[model samples]
Target: MALVFKSLRCPHCQQPIDKPLLKQHGLLQAFLKRKPFPCPHCQEQAVLPEKYETLISIGILTAVILAPLLLVWEVSFVDSKLLFGLGAALAIAGLITQKLDKA
Candidate 1:
């Protein structure tokens, strides 16, 4: 199983945010519920686009699939890094597809 990532964007300013940033701000609730998440760039509230919801589901699936592999498989460090990188790339791609919406 491969790792997958989910990306987030600020709808107001259209700025991309990584997982760490979102976690720091406790914005996952907004994303999960399609509620408004504040945009640091524009100081406005924004919500995740409907189209990008699948990305979040995919990210969860990937995590479920890859977590056990990481624990039980004899994967090398480089392989693990590459897997994680792929996950990050998926997340970034999902984020890039996001569009801003005024809430």
Candidate 2:
């Protein structure tokens, strides 16, 4: 529930970068590989922190683990679907709000 809003910034320009720009530049792959990516604003290299990556990984794992457990609990179909949808939304929110650091 600590999924507060955050913005990715360019190290050189110190300007906020959009999520779409990061996706366009393959920054998500660069995060897993611990590689630097060019900032769309200033073209300076930046990298997502290991902590951020780990947090996102954990969020995704939680959603994956919770899916089958929900079914096994025999909750009403509508309730289970609602819970799963909430979980998935949280995972994606965590991903978007995590910040990137200078390379």
Candidate 3:
């Protein structure tokens, strides 16, 4: 579950970071943050979610996220090879999101 990606921080308030900054510069210093990013819709800190219910963390979330794809081809048709593609996509997305939260 370790991540090597980076996230962005606001230049004015050092709050809600973006994707471009991280992808461009790789890493940024926390002390350089100068702005706070408030969500225009909710007026809340644009932060990431780290909280997870134990039940969901223990596989429920996995089922929830992947259920859609499984249902798409739920019929008795495809071979076991398809699972690898789905698993890879899910793993990459999860890794990116995890790194985003920390940045």
Candidate 4:
């Protein structure tokens, strides 16, 4: 969905957060820790909330599980592969743009 790829905004400056920095922070770390990291735009402490992290994790898991099933259901190999790649891209975007909580 379009909403999944929406860019995360900095709470302080309202600028879009950098994707690379969020990727470096990682989905696993964001899910497990509530630690504040500096915002790339405003340099203020920002945290990825547990709820958003959990949702992203679930979305990724769902995509991973269902994409393979598409192949089993007699979908064309190329179509299924494309769907899988799209699902993965969307999942990564969700992780990169996960909403931040004020810290």
Top TM-score prediction, candidate number: 2
RMSD of 3: 10.5
Q: What ranges in model 3 sit over 4 Å off?
A: 1-76, 99-103
Q: Relative to the true structure, how large is the alpha-carbon lDDT of every model?
A: 0.60, 0.66, 0.40, 0.64
Which model, 3 or 4, shows the larger lDDT?
Answer: 4
TM-score per candidate: 0.44, 0.46, 0.28, 0.44
lDDT of 3 by residue, 1-103 (tens): 2122454343335554544543344322321242233432233443334332222243334444455455666745643345445455555565544422322
Model 1 bad stretches (over 4 Å): 1-6, 54-96
TM-score of 4: 0.44
* Candidate 1, run of 10 with poorest lDDT: 1-10
Deviating ranges (above 4 Å) for candidate 2: 1-7, 16-32, 70-93
lDDT of 2 by residue, 1-103 (tens): 2222466677678888765666777665664465787887788888766665556666666567666577788766546566566667767766776776777
Clashing pairs in 2: none
Model 1 CA lDDT for position 102: 75
Question: With candidate 2 superimposed using the best TM-score fit, by how many Å does residue 25's alpha carbon deviate from the native?
Answer: 7.8
For candidate 2, the TM-score is 0.46
Find the candidate with the highest lDDT and give its number.
2
